[model samples]
Target: MTRPQPRPGIDEIKPYVPGSAVTGFDGPVYKLASNESALGPSPKAMEAYEAAAGKLHIYPDGSARVLREALAARYGLAPELIVCGAGSDEILQLLCKAYLGPGDNIVMSRHGFSVYHILAQGCGASTKFAEEKNLTADVDALLAQVDENTRILFIANPNNPTGTAISGEELARLREGLREDVLLVVDAAYAEYMDWVDYDEGTSLVRAAIGTGAENTVMTRTFSKIYGLGGLRLGWAYCPPSIAEVLNKVRGPFNVSLSAIEAGVAAVSDDEFVDDNRDHNRRERARVTQRLRGLGFEVGDSHGNFVLAKGRGDAPVEDVTALIEFLKTRGVTVRQMGGYFLPDYVRISIGSTEANDVCLNAISEFASQ
Candidate 1:
């Protein structure tokens, strides 16, 4: 008897490995693995989430209307140009589904988010990785890799794992160089955490795509970061009318949950909460980076809520496993970077003051030993 088979590229796709949440030590664990907000969700959002429990029996608004309008008002974008999804990850998946095929390919930075690779492969498409300079996306190198077959170009500003970012000028240059037909998707998942002068969230680029005949750019964002709604899985994209229509057509009828919608509406409306969260992250992130540098680790100037740090001295790669184990013994969970091909580095999320102190003390102890 013959067995059924999945799609061609499905088997070949490497499954994504999330940061480890487990530890051997029977003590308090500080989960600084994933880049979750240390401040937690807005109290108003929590109230909305609880209130939405009564509406679980009813189907969510397929359009996610109120949430879209809230995002629009907050960001100063047209509501019709927005497309909400379960998370920004789903928005990427929808884009891949609509645009990618066996012969097509997507281009992205070598050290960028790994989910882009998985999504492209799921659509039976290949991914081209451009080399980065100083752990940041190089506009010239990325453009060089985009050939005739490239359908999409993905950029995660203040990129994950590495936590480096390119300037707004570089982003615009990349867009100008791309073919009019190739879709440019800027994944600004960590945008809210970036308080840098040169940082651009790619919203202007998305708006620029409107009047231009070639409406080929998109900017995707998340509620998981500054909004602290990672558990609810709400995200959205700023798109041109054409792309928004395409996504709306292909997406699940009620992709976002009722709870997610209500919480998102409340979260976005609470500007004071977001401001406080950003301020806390800015302070903590700077402290963490400075302390890690003082510990002799090679740390980039990260704009995101996490820092990517490599071990001390000449043979850093050899120190990775031992250091991670040492931190585990101290009940701190930092992500290993073997999956991102940076075996020497570890990514640690910025946590509360107490949590940060615990993690730092663990590393300091490891260094002494």
Candidate 2:
């Protein structure tokens, strides 16, 4: 039997692996992987989902009008400038498909989101990796890698795993320095968790760029993190009207589900829930970071929902591995950062007071061993 040949680039691509939900143990396990909200979806979002359940047989709104209008009002952007997708990940893929090609290249940092590289490869595009300074996107380093062939620059603000963020000034410098033709794709998936003094989350930056007759900047955001709508796979991108039109052409009609649209609409209007979660994350993130530091681990300055803790340089890999296993036994699950190219580090998402206590106790027990 003869099999059809696939693109050479496709053969070499490795798929993105999300955090696992199932552990071998039968008892309850607290998941700290995937950086999801520990408190779960907003009460209003759940209610919206329940209400939409009865209409499952009917097709969802192909344009996701309700969610788009809600998002526009919340962000102070026009609905025409926004395009909703099944998830922010899907929107990323759509961007690649719409902008990249065989000879084009995408610029990203060394430890940037793995999806950027994967999607670029799938589009048969070359990827140039710049060195990240202190687990943050080095704008200077990234600029050095940009050339005539570079068409897209992907930066995850308040980036995942490391949870580091870039300032608005620094991001502006990078944008101003880039060539006129290059598109700056800012992935603000973890933006909601950030409350830094002067960070912009690239929203105003993108808006400013477009206002100044530069339509090359685009920003993508997700309801998954702050709104607790990860399971619904709802996200949206803010771009120039022309870019949004192009992306909408390639994106699947009805890409977002009916329930997801309802949930997203409700979540955006639930400002109280957003504020409470942000407040909880701010307090708990500090608590978790301090505890980890006390355990002889070096943790990065994190602004997102999670913190990254590193074992001593000389510590055995087995010791770190053992710590993860021990934590699992205590029904606590945090992400092992081997996939993020930081094998010595682990990422723990901030949970409720009780969950945080359980995780901290597990860390102490493992370190004491």
Error of 1 at 161 (Å): 1.7
Q: Which pairs clash inside model 1?
A: none
Task: Tell me the TM-score of each prediction against the true structure.
Answer: 0.98, 0.96
lDDT of 1 by residue, 1-369 (tens): 889998899999889987787546798899899998888888889999999988999999999999999999988999999999999999999999999999899999999899999999999999999999988899999999999999999999989988888889899999989999999999999998877798779988887777677899999999999989998999999999999999999999999999999999999888889898888888988899998889888898888899999877788877877888888888888888877778899999998888999999999888887
Q: What tens-digit string does per-residue lDDT give for candidate 2 at 144-241?
A: 99999999999999888889989989998899989878999999998888777778777776787788787889999999998898988988999987
Q: What are the clashing pairs of model 2? A: 86-233
Model 1: weakest 10-residue lDDT segment is 17-26
Best by lDDT: 1
| Full-model lDDT for every candidate | 0.91, 0.87
